[model samples]
Target: MTDDKIQELIGRCAERDVLAFEQLVRQFQSYAFALAMRLLCNEEEASDAVQESFVRVWKHLDRYDRGRKFTTWLYTIVTNISLDRLRAIKRNRRLFSSRDEDPSIDDIQDERDLHEIHSNEELAGMIRALTDELPLKQRLVFTLRDLQDLSVEEVSEASGMSIGSVKTNLHYARRRIRQRMAEKYNVERLES
Candidate 1:
Protein backbone atom coordinates (compact mmCIF):
# COMPACT_ATOMS: atom_id res chain seq x y z
CA MET A 1 0.00 0.00 0.00
CA THR A 2 1.07 3.57 -0.62
CA ASP A 3 2.04 5.99 2.11
CA ASP A 4 -0.94 8.19 1.33
CA LYS A 5 -3.32 5.29 1.85
CA ILE A 6 -1.52 4.42 5.07
CA GLN A 7 -1.77 7.99 6.24
CA GLU A 8 -5.48 7.94 5.52
CA LEU A 9 -5.82 4.77 7.53
CA ILE A 10 -3.81 6.25 10.37
CA GLY A 11 -6.08 9.28 10.40
CA ARG A 12 -9.11 7.05 10.70
CA CYS A 13 -7.39 4.84 13.23
CA ALA A 14 -6.71 7.88 15.35
CA GLU A 15 -10.46 8.27 15.64
CA ARG A 16 -10.75 4.66 16.87
CA ASP A 17 -12.24 3.38 13.64
CA VAL A 18 -12.05 -0.39 14.01
CA LEU A 19 -12.05 -1.15 10.29
CA ALA A 20 -9.27 1.29 9.68
CA PHE A 21 -7.28 -0.28 12.48
CA GLU A 22 -7.86 -3.72 11.00
CA GLN A 23 -6.75 -2.48 7.63
CA LEU A 24 -3.58 -1.14 9.11
CA VAL A 25 -2.95 -4.45 10.85
CA ARG A 26 -3.54 -6.42 7.67
CA GLN A 27 -1.24 -4.20 5.65
CA PHE A 28 1.76 -4.27 7.98
CA GLN A 29 1.48 -7.59 9.80
CA SER A 30 4.05 -9.48 7.76
CA TYR A 31 6.60 -6.71 7.86
CA ALA A 32 6.17 -6.27 11.59
CA PHE A 33 6.33 -9.98 12.32
CA ALA A 34 9.36 -10.53 10.11
CA LEU A 35 11.23 -7.75 11.84
CA ALA A 36 10.27 -9.09 15.24
CA MET A 37 11.33 -12.57 14.24
CA ARG A 38 14.69 -11.31 13.04
CA LEU A 39 15.30 -9.55 16.31
CA LEU A 40 13.89 -12.15 18.70
CA CYS A 41 14.86 -15.25 16.68
CA ASN A 42 11.87 -17.09 18.08
CA GLU A 43 8.59 -17.57 16.27
CA GLU A 44 6.34 -17.49 19.32
CA GLU A 45 8.08 -14.49 20.82
CA ALA A 46 7.93 -12.65 17.53
CA SER A 47 4.21 -13.34 17.22
CA ASP A 48 3.62 -12.08 20.73
CA ALA A 49 5.72 -8.99 20.09
CA VAL A 50 3.79 -8.18 16.90
CA GLN A 51 0.46 -8.55 18.66
CA GLU A 52 1.58 -6.45 21.58
CA SER A 53 2.93 -3.75 19.27
CA PHE A 54 -0.42 -3.54 17.51
CA VAL A 55 -2.15 -3.08 20.82
CA ARG A 56 0.28 -0.35 21.79
CA VAL A 57 -0.08 1.29 18.41
CA TRP A 58 -3.84 1.22 18.69
CA LYS A 59 -3.74 2.87 22.09
CA HIS A 60 -1.27 5.49 20.85
CA LEU A 61 -2.59 6.05 17.35
CA ASP A 62 -3.28 9.68 18.05
CA ARG A 63 0.39 10.21 18.75
CA TYR A 64 1.35 9.14 15.22
CA ASP A 65 2.60 12.00 13.12
CA ARG A 66 0.67 11.99 9.86
CA GLY A 67 3.44 13.86 8.09
CA ARG A 68 5.86 10.99 8.58
CA LYS A 69 5.87 7.60 6.87
CA PHE A 70 3.42 5.40 8.74
CA THR A 71 5.27 2.19 8.09
CA THR A 72 8.54 3.63 9.31
CA TRP A 73 6.92 4.82 12.50
CA LEU A 74 5.25 1.46 13.01
CA TYR A 75 8.57 -0.28 12.41
CA THR A 76 10.23 1.86 15.02
CA ILE A 77 7.62 0.83 17.56
CA VAL A 78 7.89 -2.89 16.81
CA THR A 79 11.66 -2.77 16.67
CA ASN A 80 11.90 -1.16 20.08
CA ILE A 81 9.48 -3.66 21.57
CA SER A 82 11.29 -6.60 19.99
CA LEU A 83 14.63 -5.39 21.32
CA ASP A 84 13.16 -5.15 24.78
CA ARG A 85 11.80 -8.67 24.45
CA LEU A 86 15.19 -9.93 23.33
CA ARG A 87 16.89 -8.37 26.33
CA ALA A 88 14.34 -9.90 28.66
CA ILE A 89 14.82 -13.31 27.09
CA LYS A 90 18.56 -13.03 27.43
CA ARG A 91 18.29 -12.14 31.07
CA ASN A 92 15.93 -15.04 31.74
CA ARG A 93 18.15 -17.47 29.86
CA ARG A 94 21.13 -16.37 31.86
CA LEU A 95 19.21 -16.68 35.10
CA PHE A 96 17.80 -20.12 34.36
CA SER A 97 20.53 -21.61 32.21
CA SER A 98 17.85 -23.86 30.79
CA ARG A 99 18.76 -23.72 27.11
CA ASP A 100 21.50 -25.90 25.78
CA GLU A 101 24.15 -24.19 23.69
CA ASP A 102 24.32 -24.77 19.97
CA PRO A 103 27.25 -26.43 18.27
CA SER A 104 29.83 -24.46 16.34
CA ILE A 105 29.43 -24.01 12.57
CA ASP A 106 32.26 -26.44 11.88
CA ASP A 107 30.52 -29.12 13.91
CA ILE A 108 27.31 -28.64 11.92
CA GLN A 109 28.83 -29.09 8.47
CA ASP A 110 26.83 -32.20 7.63
CA GLU A 111 23.56 -30.59 8.63
CA ARG A 112 24.49 -27.44 6.74
CA ASP A 113 25.25 -29.44 3.60
CA LEU A 114 21.91 -31.16 3.80
CA HIS A 115 20.22 -27.80 4.32
CA GLU A 116 21.87 -26.50 1.14
CA ILE A 117 19.94 -28.97 -1.03
CA HIS A 118 16.60 -27.71 0.25
CA SER A 119 14.61 -24.73 -0.99
CA ASN A 120 15.10 -21.06 -0.27
CA GLU A 121 13.24 -21.49 3.01
CA GLU A 122 15.98 -23.80 4.18
CA LEU A 123 18.65 -21.41 2.98
CA ALA A 124 16.93 -18.60 4.80
CA GLY A 125 16.78 -20.68 7.94
CA MET A 126 20.48 -21.42 7.65
CA ILE A 127 21.18 -17.77 7.22
CA ARG A 128 19.03 -16.95 10.22
CA ALA A 129 20.98 -19.44 12.27
CA LEU A 130 24.22 -17.89 11.15
CA THR A 131 22.88 -14.49 12.03
CA ASP A 132 22.53 -15.61 15.62
CA GLU A 133 26.30 -15.78 15.68
CA LEU A 134 26.57 -12.11 14.84
CA PRO A 135 26.51 -9.32 17.38
CA LEU A 136 23.04 -7.89 17.98
CA LYS A 137 23.66 -4.66 16.05
CA GLN A 138 25.19 -6.50 13.12
CA ARG A 139 22.36 -9.00 13.03
CA LEU A 140 19.75 -6.25 13.08
CA VAL A 141 21.57 -4.38 10.33
CA PHE A 142 21.86 -7.50 8.17
CA THR A 143 18.23 -8.45 8.60
CA LEU A 144 16.98 -4.94 7.91
CA ARG A 145 19.22 -4.54 4.87
CA ASP A 146 19.49 -8.03 3.35
CA LEU A 147 16.24 -9.60 4.45
CA GLN A 148 13.91 -6.60 4.62
CA ASP A 149 15.69 -4.74 1.77
CA LEU A 150 15.71 -1.45 3.64
CA SER A 151 18.02 1.27 2.42
CA VAL A 152 20.99 2.37 4.49
CA GLU A 153 19.20 5.50 5.59
CA GLU A 154 16.12 3.57 6.63
CA VAL A 155 18.20 1.09 8.59
CA SER A 156 20.11 3.87 10.24
CA GLU A 157 16.85 5.53 11.17
CA ALA A 158 15.35 2.33 12.52
CA SER A 159 18.53 1.37 14.37
CA GLY A 160 19.13 4.84 15.76
CA MET A 161 22.67 4.67 14.41
CA SER A 162 24.58 6.64 11.82
CA ILE A 163 24.60 5.61 8.17
CA GLY A 164 28.29 4.74 8.45
CA SER A 165 27.58 2.37 11.33
CA VAL A 166 24.84 0.70 9.31
CA LYS A 167 27.22 0.22 6.40
CA THR A 168 29.94 -1.19 8.65
CA ASN A 169 27.54 -3.61 10.36
CA LEU A 170 26.20 -4.76 6.99
CA HIS A 171 29.73 -5.32 5.74
CA TYR A 172 30.64 -7.44 8.73
CA ALA A 173 27.37 -9.39 8.51
CA ARG A 174 27.90 -10.20 4.81
CA ARG A 175 31.49 -11.16 5.38
CA ARG A 176 30.54 -13.46 8.25
CA ILE A 177 27.72 -15.07 6.28
CA ARG A 178 30.01 -15.64 3.30
CA GLN A 179 32.73 -17.07 5.48
CA ARG A 180 30.30 -19.44 7.16
CA MET A 181 28.86 -20.57 3.83
CA ALA A 182 32.33 -21.29 2.52
CA GLU A 183 33.34 -23.20 5.61
CA LYS A 184 30.13 -25.16 6.00
CA TYR A 185 28.86 -25.64 2.44
CA ASN A 186 32.08 -25.39 0.47
CA VAL A 187 30.42 -22.79 -1.77
CA GLU A 188 32.74 -20.17 -3.25
CA ARG A 189 30.63 -17.48 -4.88
CA LEU A 190 32.02 -13.98 -4.47
CA GLU A 191 28.62 -12.36 -4.51
CA SER A 192 25.94 -13.34 -2.05
Candidate 2:
Protein backbone atom coordinates (compact mmCIF):
# COMPACT_ATOMS: atom_id res chain seq x y z
CA MET A 1 0.00 0.00 0.00
CA THR A 2 1.05 3.56 -0.64
CA ASP A 3 2.11 5.89 2.14
CA ASP A 4 -0.96 7.98 1.54
CA LYS A 5 -3.20 4.97 2.05
CA ILE A 6 -1.39 4.00 5.20
CA GLN A 7 -1.71 7.54 6.48
CA GLU A 8 -5.43 7.35 5.86
CA LEU A 9 -5.64 4.10 7.74
CA ILE A 10 -3.66 5.60 10.58
CA GLY A 11 -5.97 8.57 10.69
CA ARG A 12 -8.95 6.30 10.90
CA CYS A 13 -7.24 4.13 13.44
CA ALA A 14 -6.59 7.17 15.61
CA GLU A 15 -10.32 7.67 15.73
CA ARG A 16 -10.71 4.13 17.15
CA ASP A 17 -12.07 2.65 13.96
CA VAL A 18 -11.79 -1.08 14.43
CA LEU A 19 -12.26 -1.93 10.75
CA ALA A 20 -9.48 0.41 9.72
CA PHE A 21 -7.19 -1.04 12.35
CA GLU A 22 -8.03 -4.57 11.19
CA GLN A 23 -7.26 -3.61 7.61
CA LEU A 24 -3.96 -2.15 8.66
CA VAL A 25 -3.07 -5.30 10.59
CA ARG A 26 -3.99 -7.51 7.64
CA GLN A 27 -1.74 -5.53 5.36
CA PHE A 28 1.36 -5.51 7.58
CA GLN A 29 1.12 -8.56 9.87
CA SER A 30 3.12 -10.81 7.55
CA TYR A 31 6.01 -8.35 7.34
CA ALA A 32 5.91 -7.87 11.10
CA PHE A 33 5.90 -11.62 11.73
CA ALA A 34 8.78 -12.19 9.32
CA LEU A 35 10.88 -9.53 11.08
CA ALA A 36 9.99 -10.89 14.50
CA MET A 37 11.00 -14.38 13.38
CA ARG A 38 14.38 -13.09 12.21
CA LEU A 39 14.96 -11.28 15.47
CA LEU A 40 13.59 -13.94 17.85
CA CYS A 41 14.41 -17.17 15.88
CA ASN A 42 11.43 -18.99 17.34
CA GLU A 43 8.07 -19.27 15.59
CA GLU A 44 6.00 -19.19 18.75
CA GLU A 45 7.93 -16.28 20.24
CA ALA A 46 7.79 -14.42 16.96
CA SER A 47 4.02 -14.84 16.84
CA ASP A 48 3.70 -13.57 20.37
CA ALA A 49 5.96 -10.63 19.62
CA VAL A 50 3.91 -9.70 16.57
CA GLN A 51 0.72 -9.85 18.59
CA GLU A 52 2.20 -7.70 21.34
CA SER A 53 3.50 -5.22 18.78
CA PHE A 54 0.06 -4.77 17.28
CA VAL A 55 -1.45 -4.23 20.68
CA ARG A 56 1.14 -1.56 21.39
CA VAL A 57 0.46 0.03 18.03
CA TRP A 58 -3.24 0.08 18.74
CA LYS A 59 -2.66 1.87 22.02
CA HIS A 60 -0.19 4.31 20.56
CA LEU A 61 -1.74 5.14 17.22
CA ASP A 62 -2.29 8.75 18.20
CA ARG A 63 1.33 9.18 19.18
CA TYR A 64 2.70 8.12 15.79
CA ASP A 65 4.52 10.84 13.94
CA ARG A 66 3.16 11.52 10.48
CA GLY A 67 6.50 12.68 9.06
CA ARG A 68 8.06 9.24 9.29
CA LYS A 69 7.20 6.31 7.05
CA PHE A 70 4.57 4.13 8.67
CA THR A 71 6.40 0.92 7.87
CA THR A 72 9.56 2.32 9.43
CA TRP A 73 7.64 3.10 12.58
CA LEU A 74 6.13 -0.38 12.59
CA TYR A 75 9.54 -1.96 12.09
CA THR A 76 10.95 0.05 15.00
CA ILE A 77 8.18 -1.20 17.23
CA VAL A 78 8.62 -4.82 16.17
CA THR A 79 12.40 -4.71 16.59
CA ASN A 80 12.14 -3.28 20.09
CA ILE A 81 9.59 -5.87 21.17
CA SER A 82 11.57 -8.73 19.67
CA LEU A 83 14.73 -7.58 21.40
CA ASP A 84 12.87 -7.47 24.71
CA ARG A 85 11.64 -11.01 24.17
CA LEU A 86 15.12 -12.21 23.23
CA ARG A 87 16.62 -10.69 26.40
CA ALA A 88 13.84 -12.21 28.50
CA ILE A 89 14.45 -15.63 26.98
CA LYS A 90 18.15 -15.29 27.70
CA ARG A 91 17.45 -14.46 31.35
CA ASN A 92 15.05 -17.36 31.66
CA ARG A 93 17.55 -19.78 30.08
CA ARG A 94 20.17 -18.61 32.56
CA LEU A 95 17.81 -19.25 35.44
CA PHE A 96 17.01 -22.72 34.09
CA SER A 97 20.38 -24.20 33.19
CA SER A 98 18.96 -27.61 32.27
CA ARG A 99 17.54 -26.32 28.97
CA ASP A 100 19.35 -27.52 25.86
CA GLU A 101 21.52 -24.76 24.47
CA ASP A 102 21.25 -23.72 20.84
CA PRO A 103 23.54 -25.70 18.57
CA SER A 104 26.90 -24.27 17.64
CA ILE A 105 28.36 -24.18 14.11
CA ASP A 106 30.50 -27.24 14.94
CA ASP A 107 27.50 -29.25 15.99
CA ILE A 108 25.73 -29.07 12.63
CA GLN A 109 26.68 -32.11 10.60
CA ASP A 110 25.31 -32.41 7.10
CA GLU A 111 25.76 -35.57 5.08
CA ARG A 112 25.23 -33.81 1.76
CA ASP A 113 28.12 -31.92 0.28
CA LEU A 114 27.62 -28.16 -0.24
CA HIS A 115 27.36 -28.77 -3.97
CA GLU A 116 24.59 -31.27 -3.39
CA ILE A 117 22.39 -28.60 -1.81
CA HIS A 118 20.19 -27.59 -4.74
CA SER A 119 17.88 -25.04 -3.14
CA ASN A 120 18.37 -21.47 -2.00
CA GLU A 121 16.38 -22.29 1.11
CA GLU A 122 18.98 -24.82 2.25
CA LEU A 123 21.80 -22.35 1.64
CA ALA A 124 19.92 -19.66 3.56
CA GLY A 125 19.39 -22.01 6.45
CA MET A 126 23.10 -22.77 6.60
CA ILE A 127 23.96 -19.10 6.58
CA ARG A 128 21.32 -18.35 9.19
CA ALA A 129 22.72 -21.03 11.44
CA LEU A 130 26.12 -19.42 11.12
CA THR A 131 24.62 -16.12 12.20
CA ASP A 132 23.85 -17.64 15.57
CA GLU A 133 27.58 -17.41 16.25
CA LEU A 134 27.62 -13.64 15.72
CA PRO A 135 27.40 -11.13 18.55
CA LEU A 136 23.93 -9.70 19.08
CA LYS A 137 24.68 -6.30 17.51
CA GLN A 138 26.37 -7.85 14.48
CA ARG A 139 23.61 -10.38 14.08
CA LEU A 140 20.89 -7.75 14.22
CA VAL A 141 22.71 -5.56 11.73
CA PHE A 142 23.30 -8.47 9.37
CA THR A 143 19.74 -9.71 9.63
CA LEU A 144 18.27 -6.24 9.08
CA ARG A 145 20.53 -5.11 6.26
CA ASP A 146 21.32 -8.34 4.39
CA LEU A 147 18.57 -10.84 5.23
CA GLN A 148 15.71 -8.37 5.60
CA ASP A 149 17.05 -6.25 2.70
CA LEU A 150 16.76 -2.99 4.59
CA SER A 151 19.01 -0.10 3.67
CA VAL A 152 21.56 1.14 6.16
CA GLU A 153 19.39 4.11 7.08
CA GLU A 154 16.35 1.92 7.59
CA VAL A 155 18.34 -0.50 9.72
CA SER A 156 19.54 2.39 11.83
CA GLU A 157 16.00 3.57 12.31
CA ALA A 158 14.67 0.13 13.21
CA SER A 159 17.62 -0.91 15.34
CA GLY A 160 18.11 2.47 17.06
CA MET A 161 21.71 2.65 15.86
CA SER A 162 23.44 5.43 14.00
CA ILE A 163 23.91 5.02 10.24
CA GLY A 164 27.67 4.84 10.65
CA SER A 165 27.27 2.21 13.34
CA VAL A 166 24.94 0.24 11.07
CA LYS A 167 27.52 0.27 8.27
CA THR A 168 30.35 -0.69 10.61
CA ASN A 169 28.33 -3.46 12.19
CA LEU A 170 27.23 -4.71 8.79
CA HIS A 171 30.81 -4.71 7.56
CA TYR A 172 32.02 -6.76 10.51
CA ALA A 173 29.01 -9.02 10.35
CA ARG A 174 29.55 -9.81 6.67
CA ARG A 175 33.26 -10.43 7.18
CA ARG A 176 32.55 -12.82 10.06
CA ILE A 177 29.79 -14.59 8.17
CA ARG A 178 31.99 -14.97 5.10
CA GLN A 179 34.82 -16.32 7.23
CA ARG A 180 32.53 -18.85 8.89
CA MET A 181 31.04 -19.92 5.56
CA ALA A 182 34.48 -20.39 4.05
CA GLU A 183 35.72 -22.44 6.99
CA LYS A 184 32.64 -24.66 7.03
CA TYR A 185 32.00 -25.08 3.32
CA ASN A 186 35.60 -24.66 2.08
CA VAL A 187 34.27 -22.34 -0.59
CA GLU A 188 36.24 -19.13 -1.09
CA ARG A 189 34.13 -17.42 -3.76
CA LEU A 190 31.57 -15.99 -1.33
CA GLU A 191 31.21 -12.26 -1.94
CA SER A 192 31.64 -9.66 0.77
Among all candidates shown, the one with the greatest TM-score: 2
Q: What residue runs in model 2 are displaced by over 4 Å at the alpha carbon?
A: 98-101, 111-128, 190-192
Candidate 2 residue-wise lDDT, 36-147, digit = tens: 8877777788899999999999999887999988889999999999889887877887788633456445545743433444454444455447687687889888888887
Best by lDDT: 2
The digit string of per-residue lDDT tens for model 1 on 1-192 reads: 887788888888888899999999999999898788767767788899999999999998888777767777778888889888877976887798754553335544464354343453444455556776787789888888887788788888788889999999899999998788687777764332
Determine the backbone clash count of candidate 1: 0
**Per-candidate TM vs. native?**
0.82, 0.86
Q: What is the C-alpha lDDT of each candidate?
A: 0.78, 0.82
Candidate 2, position 18, lDDT: 97
